[model samples]
Target: MSEVPTTRPARGRPRDPGIDARVLPAAVAELAEKGVSGFSTRAVAARAGVDRRGVHARWATSEDLVVDALATLTANLRPPLTGTLRGDLDDLVPDVARALSGQRRRVLQRCLDEVGDAPAITERFRRDHVDRCTAVLEDAFHRAAGRGELVAATTPARATEVLMGSLLLRALTVGDDAVRGDALDGVVDHVVALVSTSAPGARS
Candidate 1:
């Protein structure tokens, strides 16, 4: 994988890279500033100080740019499998909550609020982001079950949905002020109680 540059050249500083380094960062900055409604190729190009034609040449549509940006947004969130379900949740849950806490939530909320107006954008957001997140979080429970950390199979799916729903709601409504220690912790304690073995960390 080609390294993504961590910092953009100063505005109008003349970068000669593939513009990937320039545009993706610019897209995120643009998203944070404008939400989804105001996001456009022209706007992102201006933000990156690159020609709009180059952006269009790279990402044929705004949806493409947004999807690529979404990919980078969660690129660092690798799941933790420490053999104990509670341990895994303790680590994974907070990281995910923090990811949802700031501009990430803005991306989702904006796409969600005007889903009909931008159906393609919204669908891409869900497919690229929401659904991908659900898959990772839901898998943690199954891993726990396989390791005999769950007593009764009380349906991890419902608990997973509840966990995700609560987090999304909290992030959208409450924002970062509600986040604590990188763990927004929406229904997390309840979900843990519902799915954990009687011994908490015991394995069969």
Candidate 2:
């Protein structure tokens, strides 16, 4: 008799499993429209059609809710990695810069201005948002290295920081509109050139 194969059951919620799932988007929308300092759980509840207590039960505080919701929204909008390290950075950097054109950047700036003094809130932003972005870039670089596009000594973490940090500064300055296409393309070409030249055989 042939043995029947059994597949493992899927783990965790298919996606978002929290009670916050329903209200999370609304909370993020409120923060984007109103800024972090201006958000109210009651208002979020009204928009989400759930009671204020429901939001509180899931997120506990306005800071927690806003941070988690924004993180989720940002995650959804991240650009796909284009396989090669340079291509991936090119794809990601401009889209990230473009995201500043939205209301979300105002929310982020407001949070920084008001909650910068709050260690826990700031830490959560660093851990949840900043680290995740860094990780995505790192993973892309690692994939390129596996494909022989990255050199043996070019560290994914260090290279990712340089690319992402530079783009963040540019985005902060660009503000209110998409980054100029020429400048964005210049960044991508320049970074790709640097990485390609750093690879072992490119110069020879």
> Residue 96's C-alpha lDDT in candidate 1?
73
* The candidate that achieves the highest TM-score relative to the unseen native structure: 1
Every candidate's lDDT: 0.73, 0.68
lDDT of each residue in 121-183, candidate 2, tens digit only = 678877877787778777887777777776554677766876766666666666544354777
Provide the RMSD of all predictions against the true structure, rounded to 1 decimal.
8.2, 8.6
Candidate 1 lDDT tens digits, 124-181: 7778766777777778888877776676755567657867777767777877766555
Q: Compared to the true structure, candidate 2 yields what TM-score? A: 0.68
For each of the candidates, give the backbone clash count. 0, 0
Clashing pairs in 2: none
Error of 1 at 201 (Å): 15
